[model samples]
Target: MIITTSTAGRCPTCGAATVSVDDAEPWCAGCEWNLDAYDRQRRAPEFGWAWVDRWSHRLGYRLTRRQFTHLAGRPLGTGGRSAAAMVTAGVSVLLIGAVLALAVTGVWLIVAFPFPNVAVLLGVALLGLAVALRPRFGRLDPELEVLSADRAPELFALVDEVAAAIGTPRPQVIGVNGDLNAYATAVGLRRRRVLCLGLPWWGALSPPERVALLGHELGHFGNGDPRRMVLTQPAFTMLGSAADLVRPVDTVAGGGIIEMIGEALGKAFQWMLSRLLFGVHLVLVAVALRDSQRAEYLADEMSARVAGIDAATSLLDTALGHESVALAVRREMRAGHGPGRWRSAVAESRAAAGGRLSLLRQLSVREESSLFSSHPPSGLRRRMLAERPRHDPLVVLTEERAARIDAELAKEYEQIRRAVAWSG
Candidate 1:
């Protein structure tokens, strides 16, 4: 049966009336089955400040952005640079102050105690425990194959060209090894940039769309989003440890009535402190998410400029089917296939899924739009791009250049495929 926007057939599993949400893919309303809704529900919060955290951030982000725009005499959607900076700075002050108060109190408890030696020992141990509880930001993925400009000049050259087109600095480090996703991360205290491209994702794209994809990533660099994360990221990490800071720590039972009462009071104080820290962390995260979404929109604008609106939008359209493409590749590999069939696998997957747009529409049905998401919904992005004014191309990719760049990365495709083999 021919399917139109409003006409969704009954569920195959359970024959019942189908319904669609937000013009997304249809599902059996009677059976309460919808693919997109299922995906959203899976990711949705079950309990504990999840809903509160997301909505708080949404509200805080909107309020801050609107106020900043008004004060700066800038149009809404111009950029989130100033507001994010302000929020980060303000949050840092509050966090620092809280840390200092805790430190001073800890010191006072040790020095003024009746048994100063025992108090000092306990205080030192507690300090050590707090430090130990801090989050480890070490390398989690050791399998990531790092690429250098010297080794992959063609890939690096493409990066440089895209950066130049978008007027941003090229990332210092490049890594290959992901399924169908590309991301940028800030490294070290200086926040040196590293760009990681997933080969399977890259291999599936046409030459022009590759430029669009790169442009979108480069746009994040231009937006200073990852770099700005340096402050808030660590603060959020420290806040995570605040729970341990205030946890009801039990001590030796034979300490006496005074010691027992002291322990009880201390436990209550720590609990209160933990709750306060949690509240602060939620507010900061919400504020950050607002700026994060703006960064995405700004990046999209940059992608449109560098790769043209059609290419930029099409890249997003293809991204919806990335998981499907990755799955197909994994299936082939398990059957003793090699890297040669990577592109063919992607093609077959897309064909079986009824093309990129159709797959995207299906995915969007369950892609519940949330402020907590770093990026805006794919459907909204498409609409935003369509409404944006057309501009001259910032970087134009000739067919030959695109093919040549692909040839350069051709050698690394096998390595990336093997690395991702275990990922799925």
Candidate 2:
């Protein structure tokens, strides 16, 4: 609960002791300086007990710091035995062994059968080459930004306020030059960072809505499980690469001579290796993604705990509204040969909408058939949000109250869209 002081205090700017709530701007009688600003700047420090209360209230479920640390920092493993590090090391050893075996076998086969064995060697070489080059093609540039001087003040202040309220460390704030979206990286050796992108539509979000979003990101940071995600990312990448390579092989082979030849010539070895790797990847991804959805749910709860569930819920409504508008614009642009400016607007609109919708879906849905989906179902998130108590403070910050914020955002998004359309 937030505490407000009933007694008037002296204003620092005006050096006036006589200041009351009755005054229009709460200025000091002696000096014309704004007392409200002074009070805000010089508010009394929060009590320790208050922090304890806030944290206890916010984290409805009992979780120890040790458990949080373990969840957030645990390494991925294979078959409940070898960790990701161990698996990586094991893969390296297997790769070396395979290379040695190929070299020895290739030389023998070339000496014995010449042509067929030579062809087999070439195929294996090409396959291995593709696997090695896969990383180069698949690298994803960090969609997140490192915080800069310009954004530091506002973003940091917001983080500090929210973090203090929730009794957690303020996460590092990063900006992305993308559509309306933000995500929190786990606490690393470096500070935890919350990445936000520049979305014209985001400008339309009310302060409460924005705070709710921030709260969600903070939830991820506080969970401290982002590190585990970071650790497991490589496994995901490898699995994806292997899957990509295998699909073409499976298509070409149709379980026939090519498959038989490949299998005889260590293609079977590679396939077995890939399957093992993929199995581990699948397990890690499932756990990580499930944890991610949980993080979102926890964040929603935390946001409600701090700002009120209503605020968080309204924020979702606004997000959905923005997505709907953006999608409409994209459909229009696709139909017409819109200008270059409109193209970016259309792209951004789609991204903002899509990202939020994806997040919402992830939170709501329990089962997903898509292997590539990184988030839970939105319907589930909405349901969870809806289930919270009506008296929740966040609920008080209704969607109806967010109209002006939404309008401002819509106008900005539309401006970009119109500019692009006109140019096109």
Candidate 3:
């Protein structure tokens, strides 16, 4: 079965009817030929470390497997806030208290010394570091082409509709960038919702699929992850910064005995702090993994309800094909022809991927469904969608509306295309 240009065609392999959507090559429903065409490589994402990554892969598989099994049997619901959320809130409080304690200790040290001394100098350093490590209130990036409701009424309207459908408030801030991803987060002290759309992926999707993307992200508002919680989010950032500050610097040998001893002490202090931060980070992230993955499933289900199962499935498949998009951008950019041809180049790359896509997806499932991963494997996600009750798309994207939306985004897309192409 072979289908191209969103048209049905006969599958050469099994003579099965192949249906194509949104100009992508069709997969035969009968023989499942070209099913892997969305996946271009048989390689899974990695940490690029040999032994550590090997161990991580195993651990991630085990954790995801167990969690998936549980999710499969049980109903999918985030339910009320759990005790883990309370624990994370407690951690956030302790982190803030630690900063206050540091400030107090610094002041006490300076006052008790009452003269020029190492104690005074140490106090000053502590004060500076404590201030430096203060939790930063997140702000939307100024460099992004932020689109206000007036600037992109059509886009904002779509977001509003999706938000309403999903029972979440529309994001307070919306911006576009060149990455092959998108995210919705509650940012800042006020926890104002912010949504950022990555142009590469946006350009690749069909209209209903875009709805699915929005549904999946905005759905996070109702099914919150502890990491995204206002209190814990800042704590996570503060801990990461603290870890970076305490990370040891390499020392050259052949220094004086005193210097050597001082360096050793410094290294020991760094090692202790680093390990403490690592342990805390591990616990926080590990505890959140199950919930996070479950949230992904819930979000996907929401997406299907609003965007239809087929559209959501297509979106997931395209997500798995981002490597194809990335590769195409790189290939065309290097040849000095990618500035405006990125979308076409991506189409070519996907076509070239052909049979390898399925294998790539299979390999990626392990990586994508890992304990450390933010989401479950696309394969499992699609399977879950298929097993669930089907729903008609609530918001239909007519060709005319899609065209209008594209027209509105034309300027931004032009600039974004060049940026993504050249940056590749």
Candidate 4:
């Protein structure tokens, strides 16, 4: 489906060996020839702000080189998500200081309970501080329809199998929503791992491909993505808060020169704070980007290992196929079909595509390359997968078993279909 290290082709530019990933195109690892040809935006000759763009482009260019040089070729086996010391230390100071302050406030409020005025004010302050600095134990999104084992035993069993194969803990909650994607996350104070499947996507995938999806998603927790870590994730959230707090503010001046000067000074101070925040953000992000990309590669490997190379690559093809597949979803929304015929709809759309799918996929690949994209370009990912050794699927979903899952989610899909139809 993706990345292969076969040297059957030759690179015209360097006379170096060319590798074909997914058989779409042959590219050279030495020069990264056609792989970057898709990044049209990066190759643009002009920009609205030329000077700023030139500098930014240089930075991006450096980052892209750093990415492939550090990340390419071999399997990235659970490259753990890493955080910058600056971010880690800085977030720790803020949260720990806030916690300590809250503790002190609590003790003060308790001791001063004998005094009416002070106690009342301190008590109010305690509640406010506690709320403000509270641990961000993320909450489950209410939009999801929670599915217990009793409701969807076959589906839950599949999850258990995938988790076991990936060597990760089974998600405590499995839910579904009417969306085009799936995700794995930890939610609530106890940090219950949750898998929220998007019905449209779930319905599109083959049984083995679904296992690949599970492998990649569940791999997030095992790969040590700092964003998924309950302890460090809150700290990352606090950084966003700090950035917003220091964000630049526009100042309006009254008629007087003195007032104008005062406004200018205020604006300057705000700008300085904003710039400092930007610097912190830039540094922290640069540090985190490497780890994040590494984690993605590792997750893909887990997917390949758990569900076989072909299935994993086909699953990744969903990235390429999403736009084409959206037509099916839209058609379903328009038709208001109960129980949502995803497999048939998806097949119909792909069949209509004829020869255009590859071109569309290439265009999509070009459009997705960015300095800050969370995942590596799907094309590059495919190539990486091709280069790595292939693996046989560890978990397989038989047709009859898949049918059982479809039956279990039938009512939910029907309701979702009606809702989508009405909303449209």
Candidate 5:
């Protein structure tokens, strides 16, 4: 006689009633547990999947199971090696090139019979010195701690979550006393590391806003280009320093036959080297900047995926407004037009002009010289994000929730301002 048992029952753990059992033992094969024990474990938090769904609709594409897997499981350095490895490789290449150049020069000098060994030696020494100093100069400064003592726990939790999501190590957190701004620095492996959140950031931003900011920084970690900055930046600095040193030496030393020959060769070699290095640096910087910008976009998407797009957008807007107000105050001080009264006047002017201009553009134009811009214009960034497709499921909910939050925050801010004015 053959006995076949039907599989059926409710899972006590997750509260789904399609559980199965075999041989008189209570079990849920789907959830992988005995029905009795499964019922005792608490349910996980509701993921707010409805919000995510609405966002997916707004984004114009549903995240299929495969896509979701890709998002969650994809390594930070998906396309290639990590930033640290890339930097190490670049420096290695530079070293190899220097060695090859010296080898060729030595061979030519030996064969040609007329060339001075001293000149070739000097060239080799200079190259060696530059390579030797590369690591020291390239390393990023330690990140200044930016968060207040009180907010450290919250900040760490956010950093951990974002880091885990992006599959990069959580960066060292630092508190800075500055009134504005947060940045990541690639100080080399086992060194200062990434993600310095400003204290002002904590005071100014809400919890969701802070999460958005962390997502942005995580995007940087995901791209792994910060390490490139750590690697190449020192070479550029050393090259510039070498040029400065050589120029002054040539000027002070009169052109005796040896000096004249050395000067001529050195100047020519330096000129060509400078141009070549500068061109290479420029290309690399441009590529890095483009990647950095895209990283920001990706981060925004991730933040939306986790928290909701409206939260990310609101965070951007608030950060933008804070930046604008700070800029206005700085301009007033710089123009010798301050005394608190002028600051107030400038703030009023900024408010009247509206806060819709691209923050990235404003930051680049106002803060960075053209020679060292590591980011694209803010206007372009804003336009890209604004136009990009969003997930649809969370669209209505995200927009509605964001609007309500914004309105409430605006009211509170207004009241705070009024109270400050009254006190003053």
Candidate 6:
């Protein structure tokens, strides 16, 4: 259960210490923050779209997980297994393209020309096959601002400390961005390890929580998840690329009777190809998500070992409570006034919301593990940590060092925010 402070007593908008509670709705004497009124707006009572969207995602995720578990036994694989899966997927797409080419050639000969026009039929067939088989390699750019050791020695030093504590190699590269998330990913065909830290998310955490979060991301590298994902990512992209090459609705119609007949045939062929590709895409995603969920569990355990269970649990709480309080913080930040501290702002928003986190945690427990999600539910992670033996904190943060680190990165955070917005 989420232990919450008393609500109907404080103002969310203006950071007012107290509000008058009249008829169950608290009104801020300091500002226009009315708890009941803001809650209604935040929840979006109109049309119930939020609940619908959430339920739809949950349903799809549950089905995907079920299908994946039935097809592939638990603990999907190491990097090699993922690579083999991608190779098989690539070959399957190529084979489908070749079959489609032959089918197209036969149809063109029967419908367009009275006799066999060998050269033209071959040209059409080859062109269609080439189009279907073409690969769209993902973009190489990291996009976010890359931070080198020279530029941020203190941050790198902290990362090194965390890595040493966890017995993992330090990330080769570091990038900073605006997201409320931090992750370790392998980039490019070379599989370069990149540690991406989101300043917004880091700024929201306490010093101990920061250690837990950073250790968790670094753990992904040692856990073998990043390498596996890098290998399989291109294959998932290929499925979408193949589907796009023969999308049924993208076909154009011409005026002549023969042209119309050809268009209809093309549409039918495309429709069949799309359905086949979509089914393959679904299966591939399910397998990928299964691996992702396991990777997260392993990574979380590493964090628990490196940063202590209390810190890990606090990190999880911050992550779960983030979405609930994000809007209120955004509104406050947008008005030129400032809460100045993300953690305090979140706490105030939670108080205003009246322990809605208890409800969110309950929902998370009730919802089945999703194949569409990269991480397991927060409640599940918390429970797993609770069952594990406690360890001493690996890297304790002195107040002086923590404050100095924050001081150094303060300007960099602003720069990152501007860059993200400008890039968009």
**Pick by TM-score: which candidate is best?**
3
lDDT of 2 by residue, 48-153 (tens): 3655433432231122112233433222111242243345445434544554565655455545555666666765575554445232212223654455545345
- Count clashes in each candidate, considering only residues at least 3 apart in sequence or on different chains: 3, 22, 6, 6, 37, 0
Query: Which ranges of candidate 2 are over 4 A from the true structure?
Result: 1-152, 186-192, 226-264, 320-323, 328-374, 389-424
Ten-residue stretch with the least lDDT total in model 4:
38-47
State which candidate, 4 or 6, has the greater lDDT.
Answer: 4
What number of backbone clashes does candidate 5 have, counting pairs of residues 3 or more apart or in separate chains?
37
- lDDT (CA) for every model shown? 0.65, 0.47, 0.72, 0.70, 0.46, 0.63
Query: Residues 182-244, candidate 1, lDDT per residue (tens digit)?
Result: 887765556677788887677667677788989988777777563345565544556656665
Model 3, span 311-342: residue lDDT tens: 89878777777766767665664565533465
TM-score (C-alpha) between model 4 and the true structure: 0.76
Candidate 3: give the clashing pairs.
Answer: 1-11, 1-12, 36-357, 36-358, 39-357, 60-371
Write candidate 5's Cα lDDT for 1-424 as tens digits: 1122334656667655442211233444345344222111122212236554333222211112122233343432356643534544475457446645655665555555545667656655655554543434334444353443344454455467667764656676444433356776655444555566543343344555556666666566555453334444543344344344344234676858998888888888877766665555544543344344435545666555444565566555555556455555445434443223333553464456453333232332222212233443333333344554555322122334433433433333243344334544
The prediction achieving the highest lDDT against the true structure is 3
Sort the predicted structures by lDDT, highest score first.
3, 4, 1, 6, 2, 5
Candidate 4 residue lDDT tens string, 197-229: 998788777777888899999898788665576
Model with the higher lDDT, candidate 1 or 2: 1
TM-score for predicted model 6 compared with the true structure: 0.68
- TM-score of candidate 2 versus the correct structure, residues matched by position: 0.47
In candidate 5, which residue ranges exceed 4 Å CA deviation? 1-133, 136-143, 146-151, 165-167, 189-192, 226-250, 253-269, 318-323, 327-372, 387-424
Ranking by TM-score: 3, 4, 1, 6, 5, 2
The list of candidate 6 runs beyond 4 A from truth reads 1-142, 226-230, 249-252, 328-340, 349-358, 366-368, 416-424
